[model samples]
Target chain A: MSHPTSTTNKTLAHPLNAWYVAGWDYELTRKPLARTIANRPLALFRTEDGRPVALADACWHRLAPLSMGKTLGRDEIQCPYHGITYNSAGRCTSMPAQETINPSATVPSFPIVDRYRFAWVWLGDPEKADPALIPDMHQMSSPEWAGDGETIYAPCNYQLVLDNLMDLTHEEFVHASSIGQEELSASDFKVTHDDRTVTVARWMFDIEAPPFWLKNMRDKFPGFEGRVDRWQIIHFEAPSTIRIDVGVAKAGTGAADGDRSQGVNGYVMNTISPETDKTCHYFWAFMRNYCLDSQLITTQLRNGVHGVFGEDEAMLKAQQEAIDANPDYEFYSLNIDAGGMWVRRLIERMLEAEGRLAATQEPQPARVGA
Target chain B: MAANSSTVWQRGRVVELRDVARDIRRVVIEPESPVRAAPGTHVDIAVVVNGEQDVRSYSVVESDDDGTRLALSVFRTPTSRGGSVFMHGLGEGAEVELTQPLQNFPLRVGAARYIILAGGIGVTAVLGMARVLARLGADYRFVYAGRSREAMAYLDELIDEHGDRIEVHVDAEGTPLDVPSLVGGLGRDTELYMCGPIRLMDAVRRAWQDFGLDLPNLRYETFGNSGWFDPEEFVVRIPRLGLETVVPKDRSMLEALEAAGADPMFDCRKGECGLCEVEVLELTGDIDHRDVFYSQRQQEASAKMCCCVSRVVTPAATGSRERKPVISIELS
Candidate 1:
């Protein structure tokens, strides 16, 4: 195994102004919850009115983690070490031993908005916190859809997870027994990109259904076994949100031509937030539009997805260790890395723009619309 | 006499205009100066229509904390009487006069919980309330009902920002919202705030009353254009002014009176204000009292009506040859 220092030096820096899924919304309640984003410790909690707020975990006075402190009243957080209280905006409101709060007694507060059952925090300029920039995860919230998911902490860089999601050919090798099928590996795929999004789509026609799909679809369609058309459409938003729409239908059902109802459709929402250079927070939700009220299907799909992602996590962590051991080795890109590469390019462009703007010391142009 | 001091007129530039939903355009205005806007507040904007300054009130959908910019989602209804048409016609960079943010439906803080009921374009009014509640960490449920998801303004953004706290009911999806069940399911201490079409508000109000909920807990704002009775041609007799005019189905009594050169005192044409109230001398029909300004007792008395929105609906007499529901009223 390589020394820890070798891995520490290889940690990647993420863009500061982009939104990152900090954690599930239900995780941050009355109690102060602590999480790390881009290597910065953050404390998340709700005020008296139930609004979620995110602030730097460190107290400005004694450098104690605010998450260790108890929330006072509805909007104030009292440092556990010194009993100093800070308001929801991170301004020091009171000190037990001081008559007045110091002029510089404040902590950085990040803009947070709850969406798709996740609290997204903007770690950049508050003025630039445009809620519209948040990726549209409508399937998770719409009543037309239903599913369950679990958040797993992976001891690997988020980029590795992105690569894993962008390329599903590994499924045939990694998850052979569950969701994997030979058709996925044999099928050709295409990658497309716009100004802010990248999409990788694959279709396998007249192929046998995978074991997982066959198990889930048997009761819904109990006819004799037959060939089916399968598809996997992966959409990567700027930064770290990926949604994979995968399903299967009877052959020649026109499932690829915007008519998804012809097939059993399901969505895999994978949102990654970098906790540090070597570790990330992985938030995943699996949902389906059909059988929405069926708890059996929900549980079965949840477990299936959880197990599938566990396989990816094991591979990604092992890959990270390998990269750490061979620090001088440069990685080569493959045909399937197009989507992940596009995502990285977009992040680089955003970081470069932010750096240029900072160097010029120019204020962001006033935004007229959301 | 001093000019009307109640309205603090301000100039604003239309910086952005884009469709948020079918027939619903999101108008973003940058005020000449900053203006503070409380939750559930609205602003009155004035526009030129047919060479006349026509003013209409629009709920503030979103605003910066400092109120440097204001966003109003305007829905151009099929029956819009020039105001929404003019607003929809405006392009980016258009300048208009607007009143400072006015709080008619101010959100009551400190409630144990909140229930926001919105219908169609009425989502614009309740949006800020939801934002404030989310920020305060207050417990609230937002229910938005519309004919269809595509026709609902700010549906995507609201769902994105609110998560599961929002419940959307689209009639086209056959998932019509049951207002009674929703109202009855509310906690005893939950406060309800609603804004929408007249019919929806009326239905909710009826359901709320049936549930025997506290009257104080129920709050609502109307667009002033909705009425219980289908609008029909009516004859208005003004004895004091010695003028008679035919109020068309599309026109209000106030508009007809004003067009006939009679200056009638009026404000808030949406029936919330009694400024345009006129004593009914001889009502030859039953009155359709639509304004929120009067109590049930006053409406039952049938002594006066808000000429701006409330109208007379004549009932057919038993065994009468002419069974038409024509409304005829003599104004005092």
Candidate 2:
């Protein structure tokens, strides 16, 4: 039995605004790439000038994905199931099965852009996109050369990871045998958090680094005994996402200019995306002031990050299982964990900004700058 | 005269082809428009090689709901020059001109028992009829016969789903088809329809007649001359309209008439696609029910020619009048 309500309810909100990474450029060079955005399957493609476009995955005629289709002599995606070809704007271009080519037909297409070397898609309203207002990335481009960048998909919400990354103290326990040690903030180093994102930065000066296997500084310097310089930066962007940056600044002579350059400063920015309420994906890009060739800078950084991600996945999975077992495990919030509270506030504010926030929940507008 | 009009739409190139069996093929057609054909409606598929409309009529073996796409299984006739040449050249998505559907073969509408018989690739037509029958929730018996099992297309689909109601006949060494025994098996209420090479149809007709049984309406579709498209039957002239033309006797009466000059409006062509069919300005013909598409009443009142199938049966112009014709011209 169907209710005789208004018929306009068929179309719903497309989770847009903020930045949504569509896919890698190399993979979908000539063919349409098939993926799901905002809980619906979509095909991402390009026009001749490299402008990216996304459309509903299935063809309106046969319900076959446009991605499985081929481009006709004219610019468009054709369903492989049937030869029904559609244009960039999701309009049917022609029915090859017919005797004549139809010039007027179409399908629904999503708005997309390629900026900062990433294919960012607008899953919601096209009218709201402002190119001038893209996500901020201060540590990218040319030399102070950024390290290799890589990506990984997580089977959980992008929010949870943002919260986890913001609460970096977890690495001490979660990554105990890997990147973190329990001695991180034992003596009240410092912590900062408000709205937007949390930053736990402090001068780790003149202190022996964690272990004998932590990359370049596995062993401590006699002159710089228990000493090194490091600073951490992290950002949480909307709809559903998080960004984490960790950098190391040098205190002495520099190899970069041979004229006492400012030592080594490294940065790792994590871009997390919420594919669904329970699934998330992250794109991690690394940058370093120290010199490294394209091969080592590219290949090794990806491998190393992937290895670290493998560990995080196992821990996240187990943690999710525990949460599933107990629906009502109320836990108290701590001052040091201020980053997590802000991440939730950001999600709520983004939802509200898009008119998607629930009426039952009061709007907790997170204070912007931290 | 509102159903059968003879007009030829576009024809396409033979693009893709594959041999599904020893002589059967899966021919995919890339049409020029959305065909939205029902399952049972047959399309006139004309393939030209070396430049001739070597036309072969085949029922759509399968059709999508919108009638935009269709699939047919044609059993290649190796002996016929036009037939063999056309079949061997078919490739995937090749262009083929198809007339809008001319649905001449129709099952008795409503919930009636349908008995379908296919002789060989005669199965193509009934195969479509069976599908519509299933969709309509009507009970049916599909009697598929061939020289042997290999000749039958999609034999497995029938065997898998309708095995209980299906009957197979072949001129085998050991087992034979008990025709009388098979006919003797049906109850009086069943509607029987048979399509195949002449012999099998003859056998079924004889058997059913011998029993003096209540037979279902028996029908058949035979190939017509290319004149099916010629509308000129005689030198026609719209006196006041200044229209004078010769309408061929062989083409659809309306087309020939229209061409020579009398434009008779029609509607459907199975005596159904009647874009040019119209009321009687003058009527004549056996009014053959060869077109199973229309009802008895519609056919009667309309005095329809289904110009695709109907022809003029002139009275005085019968064989003798044109012997000495030297009539002068005087027009409006």
Best by TM-score: 1
**Per-residue alpha-carbon lDDT of model 2 for B68-96, expressed as tens digits?**
55666777686655755676666565566
lDDT of 1 by residue, A219-335 (tens): 467653787889999999978889999888878878877776556888999899999978999999998888878899999899988888888888989999997786555556677
Name the runs in model 2 displaced over 4 angstroms: A1-15, A97-105, A138-143, A187-203, A211-214, A217-226, A239-243, A249-262, A292-294, A359-370, B1-332
Q: What share of the true interface contacts does each candidate keep?
A: 0.00, 0.00
TM-score of chain B of each: 0.71, 0.65
Model 1 residue pairs with clashes? A49-B136, A49-B137, A49-B138, A50-B136, A50-B137, A50-B138, A51-B134, A51-B136, A51-B137, B224-B270
Candidate 1 lDDT: 0.79
Give the lowest summed-lDDT range of ten residues in model 2 chain B.
B323-332
Q: After best superposition, candidate 1 residue B70: deviation in angstroms? A: 25
Error of 1 at A351 (Å): 1.8
RMSD of 1: 20.8
